[model samples]
Target: MEKKKELENLLVSVSENDDYAFRVFYDLYYRSVFRFAYYFLRNREACGEVVSNVFVAVWKSRVALRRIENIDAYLYVVARNEANRYLKESRTRRRCLSFEEIPISLIDRNSPPPQRRRSR
Candidate 1:
Protein backbone atom coordinates (compact mmCIF):
# COMPACT_ATOMS: atom_id res chain seq x y z
CA MET A 1 0.00 0.00 0.00
CA GLU A 2 1.13 3.55 -0.69
CA LYS A 3 2.44 5.54 2.33
CA LYS A 4 0.16 8.49 1.68
CA LYS A 5 -2.96 6.32 1.65
CA GLU A 6 -1.80 4.54 4.81
CA LEU A 7 -1.30 7.82 6.66
CA GLU A 8 -4.70 9.14 5.59
CA ASN A 9 -6.38 5.94 6.73
CA LEU A 10 -4.66 6.17 10.10
CA LEU A 11 -5.80 9.77 10.51
CA VAL A 12 -9.34 8.69 9.69
CA SER A 13 -9.01 5.98 12.31
CA VAL A 14 -7.97 8.57 14.83
CA SER A 15 -11.13 10.49 14.06
CA GLU A 16 -13.11 7.29 14.45
CA ASN A 17 -11.66 6.18 17.82
CA ASP A 18 -9.31 3.41 16.79
CA ASP A 19 -6.33 2.68 19.04
CA TYR A 20 -4.50 0.45 16.57
CA ALA A 21 -4.71 3.16 13.94
CA PHE A 22 -3.21 5.67 16.34
CA ARG A 23 -0.38 3.25 17.16
CA VAL A 24 0.32 2.68 13.50
CA PHE A 25 0.33 6.38 12.92
CA TYR A 26 2.74 6.89 15.79
CA ASP A 27 5.11 4.25 14.42
CA LEU A 28 5.06 5.78 10.97
CA TYR A 29 5.56 9.40 11.96
CA TYR A 30 7.59 9.43 15.18
CA ARG A 31 11.02 9.42 13.55
CA SER A 32 10.21 12.12 11.03
CA VAL A 33 8.74 14.32 13.71
CA PHE A 34 11.72 13.75 16.00
CA ARG A 35 14.18 14.62 13.25
CA PHE A 36 12.23 17.76 12.41
CA ALA A 37 12.21 18.77 16.07
CA TYR A 38 15.92 18.05 16.45
CA TYR A 39 16.57 20.83 13.98
CA PHE A 40 15.46 23.35 16.59
CA LEU A 41 16.38 21.62 19.87
CA ARG A 42 19.74 20.10 18.83
CA ASN A 43 19.35 17.65 21.76
CA ARG A 44 17.90 14.17 21.29
CA GLU A 45 15.99 14.10 24.55
CA ALA A 46 14.47 17.52 24.00
CA CYS A 47 13.55 16.56 20.43
CA GLY A 48 11.84 13.40 21.66
CA GLU A 49 9.95 15.36 24.27
CA VAL A 50 8.73 17.86 21.68
CA VAL A 51 7.65 15.11 19.28
CA SER A 52 5.66 13.30 21.97
CA ASN A 53 4.03 16.52 23.05
CA VAL A 54 3.00 17.20 19.45
CA PHE A 55 1.41 13.76 19.18
CA VAL A 56 -0.47 14.25 22.40
CA ALA A 57 -1.75 17.58 21.20
CA VAL A 58 -2.85 16.01 17.93
CA TRP A 59 -4.70 13.23 19.74
CA LYS A 60 -6.45 15.68 21.98
CA SER A 61 -7.43 17.88 19.10
CA ARG A 62 -8.59 15.07 16.87
CA VAL A 63 -12.25 15.62 17.72
CA ALA A 64 -12.17 19.10 16.31
CA LEU A 65 -9.45 18.54 13.71
CA ARG A 66 -10.84 19.62 10.37
CA ARG A 67 -10.19 18.15 6.96
CA ILE A 68 -6.48 18.40 6.28
CA GLU A 69 -5.26 17.83 2.73
CA ASN A 70 -2.02 16.22 3.80
CA ILE A 71 -1.42 14.37 7.07
CA ASP A 72 2.36 14.67 6.81
CA ALA A 73 2.13 18.41 6.33
CA TYR A 74 -0.17 18.77 9.31
CA LEU A 75 2.11 16.73 11.53
CA TYR A 76 5.16 18.63 10.36
CA VAL A 77 3.50 21.95 11.09
CA VAL A 78 2.65 20.87 14.63
CA ALA A 79 6.15 19.54 15.26
CA ARG A 80 7.66 22.71 13.88
CA ASN A 81 5.59 24.94 16.15
CA GLU A 82 6.44 22.90 19.24
CA ALA A 83 10.15 22.89 18.44
CA ASN A 84 10.14 26.63 17.78
CA ARG A 85 8.40 27.27 21.10
CA TYR A 86 10.98 25.15 22.95
CA LEU A 87 13.82 26.91 21.16
CA LYS A 88 12.42 30.30 22.10
CA GLU A 89 12.13 29.34 25.77
CA SER A 90 15.66 27.94 25.80
CA ARG A 91 16.99 31.14 24.23
CA THR A 92 15.08 33.21 26.77
CA ARG A 93 16.58 31.19 29.61
CA ARG A 94 20.10 31.64 28.22
CA ARG A 95 19.54 35.35 27.84
CA CYS A 96 18.24 35.70 31.36
CA LEU A 97 21.16 33.74 32.90
CA SER A 98 23.93 35.56 31.03
CA PHE A 99 26.78 36.64 33.36
CA GLU A 100 27.34 39.97 31.59
CA GLU A 101 24.24 41.44 33.22
CA ILE A 102 25.49 40.85 36.76
CA PRO A 103 26.61 43.97 38.60
CA ILE A 104 30.40 44.56 38.47
CA SER A 105 30.49 45.00 42.25
CA LEU A 106 29.43 41.40 42.68
CA ILE A 107 32.73 40.26 41.14
CA ASP A 108 35.57 39.24 43.53
CA ARG A 109 37.55 42.45 44.20
CA ASN A 110 39.71 41.09 47.02
CA SER A 111 42.37 39.57 44.77
CA PRO A 112 45.77 41.22 44.93
CA PRO A 113 46.98 43.27 41.98
CA PRO A 114 49.03 41.31 39.40
CA GLN A 115 51.96 43.82 39.70
CA ARG A 116 52.16 43.35 43.50
CA ARG A 117 52.67 39.54 43.28
CA ARG A 118 56.13 38.37 44.42
CA SER A 119 58.28 36.22 42.12
CA ARG A 120 57.94 32.54 42.73
Candidate 2:
Protein backbone atom coordinates (compact mmCIF):
# COMPACT_ATOMS: atom_id res chain seq x y z
CA MET A 1 0.00 0.00 0.00
CA GLU A 2 2.79 2.39 0.90
CA LYS A 3 4.59 1.57 -2.30
CA LYS A 4 1.51 2.40 -4.27
CA LYS A 5 1.23 5.74 -2.54
CA GLU A 6 4.86 6.54 -3.21
CA LEU A 7 4.43 5.70 -6.88
CA GLU A 8 1.39 7.91 -7.12
CA ASN A 9 3.36 10.70 -5.48
CA LEU A 10 6.15 10.27 -7.96
CA LEU A 11 3.72 10.40 -10.84
CA VAL A 12 2.14 13.53 -9.47
CA SER A 13 5.52 15.12 -8.97
CA VAL A 14 6.39 14.44 -12.58
CA SER A 15 3.01 15.70 -13.64
CA GLU A 16 3.78 18.92 -11.85
CA ASN A 17 6.81 19.39 -14.12
CA ASP A 18 9.39 18.06 -11.67
CA ASP A 19 11.50 16.43 -14.35
CA TYR A 20 13.85 14.75 -11.90
CA ALA A 21 11.02 12.78 -10.36
CA PHE A 22 10.89 10.79 -13.62
CA ARG A 23 14.14 9.10 -12.71
CA VAL A 24 12.44 7.73 -9.63
CA PHE A 25 9.42 6.74 -11.68
CA TYR A 26 11.59 5.04 -14.30
CA ASP A 27 13.56 3.11 -11.72
CA LEU A 28 10.40 1.98 -9.99
CA TYR A 29 8.65 0.81 -13.14
CA TYR A 30 11.15 -0.20 -15.85
CA ARG A 31 11.80 -3.85 -15.07
CA SER A 32 8.21 -4.65 -14.23
CA VAL A 33 7.01 -3.01 -17.43
CA PHE A 34 9.53 -4.95 -19.48
CA ARG A 35 8.34 -8.20 -17.93
CA PHE A 36 4.76 -7.32 -18.64
CA ALA A 37 5.58 -6.60 -22.25
CA TYR A 38 7.52 -9.86 -22.43
CA TYR A 39 4.45 -11.83 -21.39
CA PHE A 40 2.64 -10.65 -24.50
CA LEU A 41 5.54 -10.49 -26.95
CA ARG A 42 7.69 -13.45 -25.85
CA ASN A 43 10.59 -11.71 -27.59
CA ARG A 44 13.13 -10.07 -25.34
CA GLU A 45 14.25 -7.56 -27.93
CA ALA A 46 10.73 -6.61 -29.01
CA CYS A 47 9.50 -6.47 -25.42
CA GLY A 48 12.36 -4.22 -24.40
CA GLU A 49 11.72 -2.03 -27.42
CA VAL A 50 8.05 -1.63 -26.59
CA VAL A 51 8.69 -1.02 -22.91
CA SER A 52 11.25 1.65 -23.70
CA ASN A 53 8.90 3.27 -26.20
CA VAL A 54 6.02 3.38 -23.73
CA PHE A 55 8.10 4.77 -20.87
CA VAL A 56 9.50 7.48 -23.11
CA ALA A 57 5.98 8.40 -24.12
CA VAL A 58 4.92 8.46 -20.49
CA TRP A 59 7.77 10.77 -19.57
CA LYS A 60 6.93 13.03 -22.46
CA SER A 61 3.31 13.17 -21.40
CA ARG A 62 3.96 13.16 -17.68
CA VAL A 63 2.26 16.49 -17.17
CA ALA A 64 -0.93 15.25 -18.73
CA LEU A 65 -0.78 12.11 -16.60
CA ARG A 66 -1.80 13.91 -13.42
CA ARG A 67 -5.34 12.59 -13.67
CA ILE A 68 -4.26 8.95 -13.81
CA GLU A 69 -5.63 7.38 -10.64
CA ASN A 70 -3.37 4.35 -10.91
CA ILE A 71 -0.08 4.68 -12.70
CA ASP A 72 0.74 0.98 -12.62
CA ALA A 73 -2.55 -0.03 -14.15
CA TYR A 74 -2.40 2.80 -16.67
CA LEU A 75 1.13 1.96 -17.79
CA TYR A 76 0.31 -1.71 -17.96
CA VAL A 77 -2.71 -1.05 -20.08
CA VAL A 78 -0.51 1.00 -22.34
CA ALA A 79 2.07 -1.76 -22.56
CA ARG A 80 -0.49 -4.49 -23.24
CA ASN A 81 -2.21 -2.47 -25.96
CA GLU A 82 1.13 -1.65 -27.54
CA ALA A 83 2.29 -5.26 -27.45
CA ASN A 84 -0.93 -6.53 -28.98
CA ARG A 85 -0.74 -3.93 -31.72
CA TYR A 86 2.88 -4.84 -32.39
CA LEU A 87 2.14 -8.55 -32.57
CA LYS A 88 -0.85 -8.07 -34.82
CA GLU A 89 1.04 -5.82 -37.17
CA SER A 90 4.04 -8.11 -37.33
CA ARG A 91 2.16 -11.35 -37.96
CA THR A 92 3.05 -12.96 -41.27
CA ARG A 93 0.18 -13.35 -43.73
CA ARG A 94 1.29 -16.86 -44.65
CA ARG A 95 1.30 -18.09 -41.07
CA CYS A 96 -2.15 -16.66 -40.54
CA LEU A 97 -3.80 -19.78 -41.94
CA SER A 98 -7.48 -19.60 -42.67
CA PHE A 99 -9.59 -22.74 -42.76
CA GLU A 100 -11.43 -21.51 -45.80
CA GLU A 101 -8.17 -20.89 -47.61
CA ILE A 102 -6.89 -24.44 -47.17
CA PRO A 103 -4.95 -25.58 -50.22
CA ILE A 104 -7.00 -28.45 -51.62
CA SER A 105 -4.02 -29.15 -53.83
CA LEU A 106 -1.89 -29.96 -50.79
CA ILE A 107 -3.94 -33.14 -50.19
CA ASP A 108 -3.17 -34.30 -53.72
CA ARG A 109 0.24 -32.68 -54.16
CA ASN A 110 2.00 -34.92 -51.65
CA SER A 111 0.43 -38.17 -52.73
CA PRO A 112 -1.71 -39.83 -55.40
CA PRO A 113 -5.14 -38.24 -55.77
CA PRO A 114 -7.76 -40.11 -53.78
CA GLN A 115 -9.57 -42.84 -55.73
CA ARG A 116 -13.34 -42.49 -55.31
CA ARG A 117 -15.42 -45.69 -55.36
CA ARG A 118 -18.67 -45.59 -57.31
CA SER A 119 -21.80 -46.82 -55.51
CA ARG A 120 -24.41 -48.81 -57.52
Candidate 3:
Protein backbone atom coordinates (compact mmCIF):
# COMPACT_ATOMS: atom_id res chain seq x y z
CA MET A 1 0.00 0.00 0.00
CA GLU A 2 1.09 3.55 -0.65
CA LYS A 3 2.26 5.41 2.48
CA LYS A 4 -0.40 8.11 2.21
CA LYS A 5 -3.30 5.69 1.88
CA GLU A 6 -1.95 3.54 4.71
CA LEU A 7 -1.74 6.52 7.02
CA GLU A 8 -5.22 7.67 6.06
CA ASN A 9 -6.65 4.26 6.90
CA LEU A 10 -4.78 4.20 10.18
CA LEU A 11 -6.17 7.57 11.13
CA VAL A 12 -9.73 6.55 10.27
CA SER A 13 -9.38 3.31 12.25
CA VAL A 14 -7.96 5.12 15.26
CA SER A 15 -10.74 7.72 15.19
CA GLU A 16 -13.17 4.82 15.44
CA ASN A 17 -11.47 3.56 18.64
CA ASP A 18 -9.38 0.80 17.10
CA ASP A 19 -6.61 0.11 19.60
CA TYR A 20 -4.55 -1.96 17.18
CA ALA A 21 -4.53 0.86 14.67
CA PHE A 22 -3.40 3.28 17.33
CA ARG A 23 -0.62 0.90 18.27
CA VAL A 24 0.51 0.69 14.67
CA PHE A 25 0.50 4.49 14.44
CA TYR A 26 2.47 4.76 17.63
CA ASP A 27 5.06 2.25 16.50
CA LEU A 28 5.45 4.05 13.20
CA TYR A 29 6.06 7.50 14.66
CA TYR A 30 7.34 6.98 18.20
CA ARG A 31 11.03 7.07 17.36
CA SER A 32 10.82 10.16 15.19
CA VAL A 33 8.80 11.96 17.85
CA PHE A 34 11.31 10.97 20.53
CA ARG A 35 14.25 12.26 18.54
CA PHE A 36 12.41 15.47 17.65
CA ALA A 37 11.62 16.09 21.33
CA TYR A 38 15.13 15.10 22.41
CA TYR A 39 16.58 17.83 20.24
CA PHE A 40 14.94 20.28 22.66
CA LEU A 41 15.14 18.27 25.89
CA ARG A 42 18.53 16.57 26.10
CA ASN A 43 17.73 14.47 29.17
CA ARG A 44 16.43 10.98 28.42
CA GLU A 45 13.91 10.98 31.27
CA ALA A 46 12.38 14.30 30.23
CA CYS A 47 12.34 13.27 26.60
CA GLY A 48 10.54 10.07 27.57
CA GLU A 49 7.97 12.09 29.48
CA VAL A 50 7.45 14.38 26.49
CA VAL A 51 6.94 11.39 24.21
CA SER A 52 4.32 9.93 26.55
CA ASN A 53 2.53 13.24 26.84
CA VAL A 54 2.48 13.68 23.08
CA PHE A 55 0.93 10.25 22.54
CA VAL A 56 -1.62 10.91 25.22
CA ALA A 57 -2.58 14.08 23.40
CA VAL A 58 -2.85 12.10 20.19
CA TRP A 59 -5.15 9.52 21.72
CA LYS A 60 -7.30 12.09 23.44
CA SER A 61 -7.65 13.93 20.15
CA ARG A 62 -8.02 10.85 18.00
CA VAL A 63 -11.50 11.74 16.80
CA ALA A 64 -9.99 14.65 14.94
CA LEU A 65 -7.00 12.78 13.54
CA ARG A 66 -8.67 11.89 10.26
CA ARG A 67 -8.99 15.58 9.44
CA ILE A 68 -5.28 16.15 9.73
CA GLU A 69 -3.65 16.12 6.31
CA ASN A 70 -0.04 15.80 7.44
CA ILE A 71 0.33 13.55 10.45
CA ASP A 72 4.11 13.89 10.67
CA ALA A 73 3.96 17.66 10.78
CA TYR A 74 1.17 17.61 13.33
CA LEU A 75 3.13 15.19 15.50
CA TYR A 76 6.24 17.32 15.35
CA VAL A 77 4.31 20.42 16.33
CA VAL A 78 2.84 18.58 19.30
CA ALA A 79 6.24 17.28 20.35
CA ARG A 80 7.74 20.75 20.18
CA ASN A 81 4.91 22.26 22.20
CA GLU A 82 5.12 19.54 24.84
CA ALA A 83 8.87 19.92 25.18
CA ASN A 84 8.47 23.66 25.64
CA ARG A 85 5.75 23.10 28.20
CA TYR A 86 7.95 20.69 30.15
CA LEU A 87 10.78 23.21 30.16
CA LYS A 88 8.46 25.98 31.36
CA GLU A 89 7.05 23.85 34.18
CA SER A 90 10.53 22.79 35.22
CA ARG A 91 11.63 26.40 35.42
CA THR A 92 8.62 27.25 37.54
CA ARG A 93 9.38 24.37 39.91
CA ARG A 94 13.04 25.32 40.15
CA ARG A 95 11.97 28.81 41.16
CA CYS A 96 9.75 27.43 43.95
CA LEU A 97 12.25 24.83 45.17
CA SER A 98 15.83 25.16 46.21
CA PHE A 99 18.43 24.76 43.43
CA GLU A 100 19.80 21.65 45.13
CA GLU A 101 16.35 20.01 45.25
CA ILE A 102 15.97 19.56 41.48
CA PRO A 103 18.30 17.29 39.54
CA ILE A 104 20.94 18.95 37.35
CA SER A 105 19.77 17.07 34.26
CA LEU A 106 16.51 19.03 34.11
CA ILE A 107 18.46 22.10 33.18
CA ASP A 108 18.19 22.32 29.37
CA ARG A 109 21.49 23.78 28.25
CA ASN A 110 20.79 23.16 24.57
CA SER A 111 17.91 25.63 24.64
CA PRO A 112 19.19 29.10 23.96
CA PRO A 113 19.07 31.56 26.82
CA PRO A 114 16.01 33.80 26.80
CA GLN A 115 16.54 37.08 24.99
CA ARG A 116 15.57 40.30 26.72
CA ARG A 117 13.55 42.75 24.67
CA ARG A 118 14.99 46.25 24.37
CA SER A 119 12.56 48.95 25.39
CA ARG A 120 12.87 52.41 23.91
Candidate 4:
Protein backbone atom coordinates (compact mmCIF):
# COMPACT_ATOMS: atom_id res chain seq x y z
CA MET A 1 0.00 0.00 0.00
CA GLU A 2 1.04 3.62 -0.49
CA LYS A 3 1.03 4.32 3.23
CA LYS A 4 3.30 1.36 3.91
CA LYS A 5 5.77 2.57 1.30
CA GLU A 6 5.74 6.04 2.79
CA LEU A 7 6.36 4.63 6.26
CA GLU A 8 9.17 2.48 4.89
CA ASN A 9 10.82 5.51 3.34
CA LEU A 10 10.46 7.46 6.56
CA LEU A 11 11.90 4.53 8.54
CA VAL A 12 14.88 4.33 6.22
CA SER A 13 15.51 8.01 6.74
CA VAL A 14 15.12 7.56 10.49
CA SER A 15 17.75 4.82 10.46
CA GLU A 16 20.09 7.36 9.00
CA ASN A 17 19.35 9.74 11.89
CA ASP A 18 17.35 12.22 9.83
CA ASP A 19 15.57 14.40 12.35
CA TYR A 20 12.74 15.39 10.03
CA ALA A 21 11.99 11.79 9.12
CA PHE A 22 12.07 10.83 12.75
CA ARG A 23 9.64 13.61 13.54
CA VAL A 24 7.34 12.41 10.79
CA PHE A 25 7.50 8.86 12.01
CA TYR A 26 6.82 9.99 15.56
CA ASP A 27 3.88 12.11 14.53
CA LEU A 28 2.38 9.21 12.60
CA TYR A 29 2.53 6.79 15.50
CA TYR A 30 2.47 8.76 18.77
CA ARG A 31 -1.27 9.09 19.23
CA SER A 32 -2.00 5.46 18.43
CA VAL A 33 0.72 4.30 20.77
CA PHE A 34 -0.51 6.59 23.54
CA ARG A 35 -4.06 5.32 23.19
CA PHE A 36 -2.84 1.72 23.22
CA ALA A 37 -0.87 2.37 26.40
CA TYR A 38 -3.82 4.13 28.00
CA TYR A 39 -6.07 1.14 27.30
CA PHE A 40 -3.80 -0.97 29.48
CA LEU A 41 -2.60 1.62 32.01
CA ARG A 42 -5.91 3.43 32.62
CA ASN A 43 -3.96 6.44 33.90
CA ARG A 44 -3.16 9.54 31.90
CA GLU A 45 0.26 10.18 33.42
CA ALA A 46 1.35 6.55 33.14
CA CYS A 47 0.14 6.37 29.54
CA GLY A 48 2.11 9.54 28.75
CA GLU A 49 5.22 8.06 30.33
CA VAL A 50 4.78 4.80 28.43
CA VAL A 51 4.34 6.62 25.13
CA SER A 52 7.48 8.68 25.75
CA ASN A 53 9.53 5.65 26.72
CA VAL A 54 8.34 3.71 23.67
CA PHE A 55 9.43 6.49 21.31
CA VAL A 56 12.70 6.96 23.12
CA ALA A 57 13.38 3.26 22.65
CA VAL A 58 12.50 3.44 18.96
CA TRP A 59 14.83 6.38 18.47
CA LYS A 60 17.57 4.53 20.30
CA SER A 61 17.08 1.47 18.11
CA ARG A 62 16.66 3.33 14.86
CA VAL A 63 19.42 1.33 13.19
CA ALA A 64 17.19 -1.72 13.40
CA LEU A 65 14.22 0.05 11.92
CA ARG A 66 14.79 -1.52 8.53
CA ARG A 67 14.14 -4.97 9.93
CA ILE A 68 10.74 -4.17 11.40
CA GLU A 69 8.00 -5.72 9.24
CA ASN A 70 5.12 -3.85 10.86
CA ILE A 71 5.77 -0.54 12.56
CA ASP A 72 2.29 -0.30 14.04
CA ALA A 73 2.54 -3.73 15.64
CA TYR A 74 6.03 -2.96 16.92
CA LEU A 75 4.92 0.31 18.50
CA TYR A 76 1.92 -1.34 20.13
CA VAL A 77 4.05 -4.12 21.61
CA VAL A 78 6.52 -1.58 22.99
CA ALA A 79 3.71 0.49 24.49
CA ARG A 80 2.13 -2.53 26.13
CA ASN A 81 5.43 -3.74 27.54
CA GLU A 82 6.31 -0.31 28.91
CA ALA A 83 2.86 0.08 30.48
CA ASN A 84 3.18 -3.30 32.22
CA ARG A 85 6.66 -2.45 33.44
CA TYR A 86 5.43 0.85 34.79
CA LEU A 87 2.60 -0.84 36.63
CA LYS A 88 4.91 -3.42 38.18
CA GLU A 89 7.37 -0.77 39.33
CA SER A 90 4.58 1.37 40.74
CA ARG A 91 3.23 -1.58 42.73
CA THR A 92 6.68 -2.34 44.08
CA ARG A 93 7.23 1.25 45.12
CA ARG A 94 3.89 1.42 46.95
CA ARG A 95 4.57 -1.87 48.73
CA CYS A 96 8.02 -0.70 49.83
CA LEU A 97 6.71 2.63 51.08
CA SER A 98 4.03 0.88 53.16
CA PHE A 99 6.48 -1.23 55.15
CA GLU A 100 5.92 -1.02 58.94
CA GLU A 101 9.66 -1.14 59.66
CA ILE A 102 10.25 2.32 58.25
CA PRO A 103 11.91 4.39 60.96
CA ILE A 104 10.02 7.39 62.38
CA SER A 105 13.31 9.33 62.39
CA LEU A 106 13.20 9.16 58.60
CA ILE A 107 9.99 11.21 58.63
CA ASP A 108 10.01 15.00 58.09
CA ARG A 109 12.08 16.68 60.83
CA ASN A 110 10.76 20.26 60.53
CA SER A 111 7.25 19.73 61.88
CA PRO A 112 5.97 21.69 64.93
CA PRO A 113 6.11 19.91 68.31
CA PRO A 114 2.95 18.34 69.72
CA GLN A 115 1.03 20.65 72.09
CA ARG A 116 0.49 19.67 75.79
CA ARG A 117 -2.97 19.72 77.50
CA ARG A 118 -3.46 22.78 79.80
CA SER A 119 -6.27 21.30 81.99
CA ARG A 120 -5.23 20.11 85.49
C-alpha lDDT (0 to 100) for residue 49 of candidate 3: 98
Candidate 1 Cα misplacement greater than 4 A, ranges:
1-3, 64-66, 95-120
Measured against the true structure, the TM-scores of the candidates, in listed sequence, are: 0.70, 0.67, 0.79, 0.81
Worst 10 residues of 4 by lDDT: 97-106
Q: Which stretches of candidate 3 lie over 4 Å from their true place?
A: 98-120
Per-residue lDDT for 13-110 in model 1, tens only?
A: 88787888778878888988998888778899889889989999889988644477777788889999999888888889877845877655556577
lDDT of 1: 0.80
Worst 10 residues of 2 by lDDT: 105-114
Q: Write out the backbone clash pairs for model 3.
A: none
Q: Arrange candidates, best lDDT first.
A: 3, 4, 2, 1
Full ranking by TM-score: 4, 3, 1, 2
Q: Extract clashing residue pairs from model 1.
A: none
For model 4, how does the per-residue alpha-carbon lDDT over 1-120 read when each residue is reduced to its tens digit?
998888889999999999999998888888899889989989999888889999999999999998999888888888888999999999998778554666555564676555678997
Provide the overall lDDT of each model, using Cα atoms, as 2-decimal numbers.
Answer: 0.80, 0.83, 0.94, 0.88
CA lDDT, candidate 1, residue 2: 100
